[model samples]
Target: MDLGFGREKRLLTPQQFKAVFDSATHKVSSKHVLLLARDNQLEHPRLGLVIGKKSVKLAVERNRIKRQIRESFRHNQSILTGVDCVIVARRGIADLSNIELRQQFDKMWKRLARQRLAADQANSTGQTNA
Candidate 1:
């Protein structure tokens, strides 16, 4: 599978980000990060980053955090299909080192993948029972 971080794998427009924000059906969070996700009706998952200055304070720090998030997503995209996710950065995230950031995102991605699997199973079973 092509696990590249291309434009098609990113939530480029405000409208796409807004859709995930407004109707996020799954949420995974930590002290300094929150991940919100919903079904996108697509073949691959798209990622949106919301690392505001208020959270990270400096542009460099925010960019670093975004890079870590995107890298983690790229490595885990195979298991994250058919979802649109928005990762919101909170205060204190900038304090984490690169290794910590990577670990945190890896944990969050696993949780989100599990949620997606459960949702898919539920949908399939619900359809059959209907």
Candidate 2:
């Protein structure tokens, strides 16, 4: 992935998302998905993508999605701070190009930022925090 155009703050490890998924609150929808990730607090925001065989039949297709996601994250990971994210693909995602993938990723990132800000505001208010 040629992500040198932007710097990514990544915590690249399986255990990171695993721990968050084990105990985190989450929100999901067709346009975007997210987890209220706080497991890897001391490190920078990180990302993981699950492109299963069921989503993309061929290994090459699956790898392409993974690569696109990695590049997307590398290019935009800074927008997500103090959180861990894992983007699991739906079955229809294989045909998207790198640009399309990035656009989808940007949408997801925007949704995530909205959620994070809401969560922070809720926390500050001691209200119903996700």
lDDT of 1 by residue, 1-130 (tens): 9979989999999999999999999999999999999988899999999999888888989889999999999999988989999999999999999999999999999999998889889999999999
TM-score of each: 0.95, 0.75
- Full-model lDDT for every candidate: 0.93, 0.64
Listed per model in order, the count of residue pairs whose N, CA or C atoms clash below 3 Å is: 0, 0
Please identify model 2 stretches exceeding 4 Å from their true place: 1-14, 31-39, 127-130
Q: Per-residue lDDT of 7-126 in model 2, one digit per residue for the tens?
A: 344435678667666766445445322334443563356666666787779999788777777777667656665676767677678777778877887776677777778877778888
On TM-score, the leading prediction is 1
For candidate 1, what is the TM-score?
Answer: 0.95
Which clashing pairs does model 2 show? none
TM-score of 2: 0.75
